[model samples]
Target: MSLVMQENLEGKAEIPRIINDGKESVEDIISNRKQISEKQDELEEVDRELRDISNELKSYDLPEDVDVSSLESQRSEIEGRISEMRQEIGRVEHEIETLDEKVDEIDEKWREEAAKESKHRTMMRKLDFVEDAHEELTEIKQTILAQIRENTEENMNRYFNDLIWKDEDYTVELGEDYTVSVYGRHGDNKIGSLSAGEKQVLALSFMSALTKISGFNAPIVIDTPLGRISSKPKKRIAQNLPDYLMDTQITFLMTDEEYTDEVRAHLQNSVANEYLLDYSNEVTEVKGR
Candidate 1:
């Protein structure tokens, strides 16, 4: 029993050492476990960071054969082109401003030209109106003159045929210049060949026609009407004159040589009254006959 006690005391002493040593070993094991847990947490963080980097790389989706250096070169070239484009835009804007100024100038010029054109158009319209009016007046004048000429021709022919003692048929034509042309048989002009008496008869006929067509009611007076005519033409004229101018008032002042017995006999039937003018002692006196 005493040996067993001694052995137990020794065992107890040895047990404390052993337990202390075991405590040291357990502390080491616990420290090593803490270090291992820290390493695992760090590994997990690294894995998460690697996954994020892989997802970023996948989003880029770069082809396997693409060169990073070439992409960088292309980026520099694109930047250079963008700089050139900006300069070109500035130049274009300046040109646009210049063109705007030119357009404004052109617009002002066009406005002035348009005003002139408007005035020209107004003048042209007035010219057209004047031309039309002139044409209308000319036409009316021509028509009136034509009517006057035709009436004068008819009356002259009637009076001439009545008084003329010629056996041939004669035609009297009034030229546009108011010259008298007498045509005889075979269309020959007889004015140059007519005797003084015949010409006087033609002049009397023309005068009578003109007076009738003059549209005046004034009395006609004549002196020496048949002075150049022969006795036969004078008698014939006196016979036809009163009848042709039946509606007109006419007076004849004649000398005794012109107022022959034969002319008086033909005109006395148509005379309503007679007057004589006598010039003696440089004074004129009118006496009723």
Candidate 2:
């Protein structure tokens, strides 16, 4: 997999492939995230007020030492304060309801605007939107996301199986927070537990699947394609990768470990041009392989 695909699987903190190559700049999407954050701040303020009211109501508890009948005047004062607090609480509760309604309205508008912009609505969703729409928009967003994830997973799994030359079965699930979970014979496999070579394979598979599904015919360039894998897998990859890519052009940046004699022999017929970089004390030179 490529760095871009790895970034997508890791989290949205790193930029992923831009599904919309339209005139919209990165600033536009970032602005959307910022707007969502500001709206969230507003909601938090309303929540704090509601919490304060609730705390005030709880504070009206009478002390165990106090006698209600003996302190009749004090009891009346307490009653009056309790009544006033209840009314204020009701008012604050109403504000919370109103704020929630407004947030829902804005969320709907944002979804509509994203659709109109021809951007991927799934990609446009922010964490605040997910939390705010917990009851209302969760189902709607899940339905859309499920469909896209299913297609992407199917493509990704197929490509991974073929490229990795593995006989076993595994599943790929695209999760929330831009996480990619791999399920193998053990039920669930953590990406962190995988070796560097395995990570590379997974990333390549995902990138290939994304490109295929997106209907993009652009050439692919992979840096350090087989840097970490053991000998057996490297041989298999070198032999199979060109065929897997088919007509799509692929460029690989490789060190001596990756572009070994075995790899060169496997790619003998497919090779169009090759180069060797020679580095010395001051300068470097590129020579034909």
Candidate 3:
């Protein structure tokens, strides 16, 4: 029985028996040491992690006199302020959106106004051109009218001097309004002071000057040619008339009171025909001489 028990113990104690052998024990010891070195490296890594966690905890450590309640209140106030700022940001964004819309509307209006301005500018240019043309035409009209006034005035003076009794004592002026003025030797207007005979002579001179300048060769007929003239003036006028009207055909209708013997003597050489009217039983017949 003791032997059987010993045999069982020897089977359970095989590891001890193997440890007693030097080569097998040494191999087992080397393997165990490698496992221990691996475990030690793992332990060193765990220790470094623990030290890092402790250092982080030290950083989070509160001071002895730190106010938790005040910090909590400040944090709550900061959160409230942040919430208000978010609301303000939302309102500002809304306002910016409205302003952008307004800006776009203004840009559209500006484009329409620019188009109208372009059209108005074109019309203004045309207006300027028309105004310039009108001004040029007005200037030309004034220059032509001025030239006519000057020529008429010169011709009036020449004919007036030749026919008038006091020839060298008067100057005639023609105004822009076609009004005639006669200035005497003393530069006084003598038109209102002239006698009927002088006035008639002046009218005849003016008519002759107009006929000469009219560029028309039509025959002139004068009724009662020397009716308002004195005897001496009528004789002088009759003498000068044929010479002055040399190129024109003129007929003078005269009465017995105006066609005196002296006037007829001065005008007989220029007279082509003379006529007498005989009235009987309210019937008149013109007989030529």
Candidate 4:
């Protein structure tokens, strides 16, 4: 039974392929990641604000002397507006989370079928009539599995190394589960774990790496990445981001406090565009200044 399963898996799986066009420009890669992260963050802020507005309508109360009917009508209108915003926000958020899932699906199908073709390459090498197709199938599956493992390892390592944890870059595990295990630095380990900030960075970093390695084009986006960090680290992030992520276009969505002039100057040369979003009566608008 195990052999049969292995045969089927190999017969339907795909082999590994890596880029040979030379290493990608680190600058372009990081810039793209930043663009995507910023856009996603913008949508998230809008979604949260809409939720708060919806809750405000639900909690509205008027004085006894006020026109109850008119007040109720106003509240209802606000509620309807929030509902509309929620629908739009939901759609946008879904697209962000699944960003390149469709691409993955398409590539996965191709890889599975390519595994079968690889066997033909081997069979042609051997002059013997390959009647034992199962032998070939098993080999293909192993090859495909090995490829997947290698890709995941490389993808996890690059970003995990950038983590600011005290531990020596060992908290990351990309073998079985997409889980990050933070361990103590060369001492007694108290259950390994990734902090919220570390996990966020790892996820963002992996997303960027996967897109680049998979040969798919995507704009990098990072929203409120410093939400978990202090002003000091945030400043450090602003100063060195472009150095690590050179040419990648990035969009950084941030609060005013997080987007101070000092921070802006640090990233000015790296940032292609800067935007300002301000709240207005019954409407919020995007402005580029």
Candidate 5:
């Protein structure tokens, strides 16, 4: 086999080999059997005619007034017919024997084919088992994902509530697709309509909730933290984010304007391993703070 076909086979489950090639097809075998049957029927008809001729000869009676010459002529003609009928019977019997031999050969092939068919059925059953297992695994995976989403949704709303100080009536919705939306007292507040500060806050809350529920331990990193938001929302996020992500390590990439003295004070006790990036001679150096 080619390397590709071999690799494919290695990745797949074992199945029965097909044994249908290099032999007459089932349809052809059936046609041969039908012909044999037809010939046998013809043979039977010929035998019946032979028996009828014998019966006619035995049951024949001549009138006492009939001439002797006429009787002999009639007997000769009857004998001639009987001879011809016997010859036909012999030919038909020989034909039937030849047909029977062919039928036997075809029957043996059928028996061998039945064995292959049995293997094919077994393989089909194995395939059905694999299909059933896949379906069950898919259902289990969906169930787990649904439960994770539910927990994520709960966590998202909780974090959103803590971060969003002004919008107490707003609720966070986490879709199965992991898209986050905020619902206000009036209706759904579109993410596109939110101010930059609000978007940052929402993103922080959503990520915190997702990380908390995902069951994977990883560090949280945010680039340009609170860079786009106004002063009020910036301070709010700076105060809340550290507490929300207390369980995981967080790294912040920020500009001087974004990381104010007040925000630093808010994170003083929780902060660890702070660094500054200093550019000199077309290269940046990491400086410990």
Candidate 6:
């Protein structure tokens, strides 16, 4: 599998290797990491055993009547045992610390891998969406083209009716531009040639048409929806938005000016829910597992 990178170079695709060593590599790393963790746990067990032995040694009140040398020898044996236990405990703790560091490193690597996987998944999902859109466009190719033709004609008549133009034809081109290319009667130019404001109108019109046709009754989340429009065009959008998004679920993410009280009041009639995120004074708690 390949990680999805937005900056896909000219030669970036990796050839599918017949013999995959990735699984083996992953197994090795996982095995090593697991071994370290297990060893650390075992070390903790040994430390507890040593502590118990030390406590037992202290609990035994040696008899005063016993031979001094014999008592010394017995105490020495216990001391030796305690010493060995302490050494073992130290060794286990060192190994545990080492394993802890190694586990941390493993986690860091997994984090990087997860991020790459997420990006790859996101890229694949996007491709799937585009392919679906393309398929949808393919299925309704003629219908959408006709709609575009009709809508474009209406917009041109309303906006550029008095302007001098060239080709006066607005025939819908089927599958030619994926329903995006608009051959203006002014010069038969593509929609790409349209002015900024015109492009905004076209985009809004296209979105309205798309959502209306798709029939997905979901909230519309708009981030800076009016970034590309002027006051006049924004007002026009405010007035004309209802024509397209009549009863459809919609959400608009906006800033102060974009979500002004007037704008909110205007959209409130169209939208049933609204929220404002003000981080001026907020607090959050963080904890670790």
lDDT of each: 0.74, 0.67, 0.71, 0.59, 0.71, 0.57
- The prediction achieving the highest lDDT against the true structure is 1
Better of 3 and 6 by lDDT: 3
Q: Where's the lowest-lDDT run of ten residues in candidate 1?
A: 1-10
Q: Which portions of model 5 show Cα errors greater than 4 Å?
A: 1-86, 231-236, 279-283
Per-residue CA lDDT of model 1 for 1-289, tens digit only, reads 4443445455545545544554554555455455555645655555565566457556897888967567556555555555554555455555555555654655555555455555555666676798899999999999998888888988998888888888888989998777888998899999999988788788888988888888775788887888887777788888889876777888887888899989988999888987778889999998888
Residue 166's lDDT within candidate 1 is 81
Please give the RMSD to the true structure for each candidate, in Å.
41.0, 29.5, 37.0, 45.8, 10.1, 26.2
* lDDT computed for candidate 3: 0.71
- Superposition TM-score, candidate 5 onto the true structure: 0.63
Model 4 clash count equals 30
Candidate 3 lDDT by residue in tens digits, 101-166? 654655555565555555655666676798899999999999987887787778778777777876
lDDT tens readout by residue for model 2, 140-206: 8888777777777887777676667567777777765547777788887756677788788889878
Summed backbone clashes in each candidate are 0, 2, 0, 30, 0, 3
Q: Candidate 4, residues 1-289: lDDT per residue as tens digits?
A: 4444455456544333211111222333344456556655665665676567557657877457767677556656656655665665565556544544544554565565566556655554453345356678889988876676567667666555654543465544454544544345564433335566666666655665556556544567778866766565555667655555555667788888788787888888887777788888978888888
State TM-scores per candidate: 0.59, 0.46, 0.53, 0.44, 0.63, 0.37
Total clashes in model 2, counting residue pairs 3 or more apart in sequence or in different chains: 2
Task: Give the alpha carbon lDDT tens digit for every residue of 121-239 in model 6.
Answer: 67878978998999888979878776765655454443332221233544323244545556655647565666676665666665665566566766666567766655544655665
Stronger candidate by TM-score (2 vs 6): 2
Candidate 4 weakest ten by summed lDDT:
16-25
Model 5 lDDT at residue 190: 67
Clashing pairs in 2: 1-203, 1-204
Report model 3's TM-score to 2 decimal places: 0.53
Question: Ranking under TM-score, best-scoring first?
Answer: 5, 1, 3, 2, 4, 6
| Residue pairs clashing, model 5 | none
